[model samples]
Target: MAAGAPRIFVSHLSGIAVFDPAGDQVGRVRDLVVMLRVGQRPPRLLGLVVELATRRRIFLPMTRVTAIQSGQVITTGVLNVRRFEQRPTERLVFGELLDRRVTLTETGEEVSVLDLSVHQLPARREWEIDRVFVRKGRKGSAFRRAKGEALTVEWTAVTGFSLEEQGQGAESLLATFEQLRPADLANVLHHLSPKRRAEVAAALDDDRLADVLEELPEDDQIEILGKLKEERAADVLEAMDPDDAADLLGELPTDDQERLLRLMQPGDAADMRRLMSYEDRTAGGLMTTEPIVLRPDATVADALARVRNADLSPALAAQVYVCRPPDETPTGKYLGTVHFQRLLREPPPSLVSSILDRDLQPLDPEAELPAIAGFFATYDMVAAPVVDEAGSLLGAVTVDDVLDHMLPEDWRETEFHLDEEVATDGS
Candidate 1:
């Protein structure tokens, strides 16, 4: 469901089809995983257990889930096919919570849980079980109740499913900071002790940890990554931006890098290897492998649709690169650029190739930092496409990446006084 959507009963979602952005069926939702809090607080909705066509059930984290509507769940098309292994802290909504006997706080009468309603918190991406559908009756493990009166009550009214204690792990901390931005959350993690940091990192979903890792200092990134399992580390790396992932992989021992690369998807591994082939401060090294690339025949509507993606950074969405046949980097032939503003001004069906800015030269893959900075400054551009010797589009180097490389090496240490805020006694 979209943010601010009405609470959805669990029964409505059971057995629903799950599809990727391309509208291809990936699986069917079998159950949901949630983590119960210490008190009467409603459990946090972690993810869905989706059974793929092969009948292998995998965990589809809420972070990767873009929308839930009438009959299907739409994901960001990023799937981790790893088998779903229930963690110590997780509780299955269907298998465990439903048809269970729980006590009503006021009446002291036992009731059977028929269904639970989950809602996304206002203006936040987090979802939680806010209401419980229950009937006053003797407890039995049956989904249907034919006799007693049934009513939907707030989650706080019932008390039967075991609640986690406050001090055990990172569940409390994660719930407390569920709404934090990646950078702000990174600051929180930086202040934590190594053991606690590892705990919190382990608790965070891959997409979240990936964003936080991008904002963390290189040392902190390496430390937290080192503490994770190799497979998980590879998954987190795959979730990160191609440029950032390549930078992290570059710091590891060659053998360690190779091992992680082997665990990653072949396409992602190739991007990392290609990025690592460039000098650290060069355009090729700084550019993200995934850019908004469209073919010559793509319409303004197509370009606008791609730009609407919430996952893209502002700079990356500022413009789109129009190329020849293969609409992926290294794209067929580096044609030209189509700015978002131009897309807006043109008719929806207008061809993007017709309005391209061909006069502006694309950056050479090996362009140095100073030259890249100069190019941005001279053209007043937020992003510029990078092309290789054979005229293939390598990727686009964004202005943020240029400034990141040009800034002092210790910039992240003092970046917004994170060091002082994280220090003991603020010393």
Candidate 2:
């Protein structure tokens, strides 16, 4: 859902049907998954536990939720079907939070949590528990119908639910490291004991883990992925960039790779299979399957919107590939590219085809790492489209991926020291 979406109570969401973009019922909401913050700050609403028709529950990230209507949750139709497993840092709203007693900060009165309200943050996809609907005093006895005072208070007005500053285990550590960048977090995780590393990895949400995994050494990536349950591992892999995920998958034994691939969405699995087919250092292998693709008829406005997606890396967002029908990867005949800068110069209503950069030769799928690196350097381009022999747009190879392949394998393992004072400094 977009930012400023209406607040929704936990009670109202219970058992609500979740539908896809096509209005087909996919599942029912079972519970909410949230991670408690370090202080009185509201817990981030990670996602929902949705039980499907077969009674298998899966995690539905808030990012995938397009809209939340009364008694209905509409998804973007993209879902990770692996069974939901609670992480060390996650809490279940129904299973653990409801009816629990917490102290109200105002009058120091202990209140029972009847419900909690969550709202999407402005200009972001994040959702947080903003308010608590609670009842003061104990529940009424069965014989005498005694009702306690009911009140709704800000989440900060409650003293419980936050992670303890001195708390033990990964939950507290996660809260402390919540703001760390993926690369920085990977560095921290690399130095931790294997056991502690596993604990922290298991506690991270799929997206966070995926990003960190991409930044970690190959050995650490294998070790951590092996520690997770097969289903959860599959979920994390699904969350990763297609090129990164394929690389990780390639390191696994054939049997293990096939198993995880079987668990992934068919389209995602297809992408993985396609990427795995090319030589590891080739343009096809380094290209990300998902790129900003637009049709000839698309306007500059449409291309700009795709380029604005937060999930895309800077390299990938640098330009968009214009193609024929089948806008997805391995799309119909490749047309040309439209750079982000060019799009800015055109009117919003102008068709992207008018300003296409047709002169630049797209990367060949079989182009070796050396050729890929040279192309980026020669053109001073951050990204280039990969087209097949049939002139179909395959995907886009990014400069970062080219550099990754060209760098020494041990480069990521090089240890660098940070000043103790600077390391501890946070402002």
Question: TM-scores of all models?
Answer: 0.59, 0.59
User: Which whole-number lDDT from 0 to 100 does residue 385 have in model 2?
Assistant: 93
Write the residue-wise lDDT of candidate 2 on 64-89 in tens digits: 78899867999877677777877655
| Overall local distance difference test of candidate 2 | 0.86
Worst 10 residues of 1 by lDDT: 417-426
lDDT, residue 349, candidate 2 = 99
Model 1, span 181-291: residue lDDT tens: 888788667756677789999999999999999988899999999999999999999999999999999999999999999999999999999999999989999999899
- Per-model RMSD to reference: 17.1, 18.5
| Candidate 1 residue runs with Cα over 4 Å from true position | 1-168, 415-427
Worst 10 residues of 2 by lDDT: 418-427
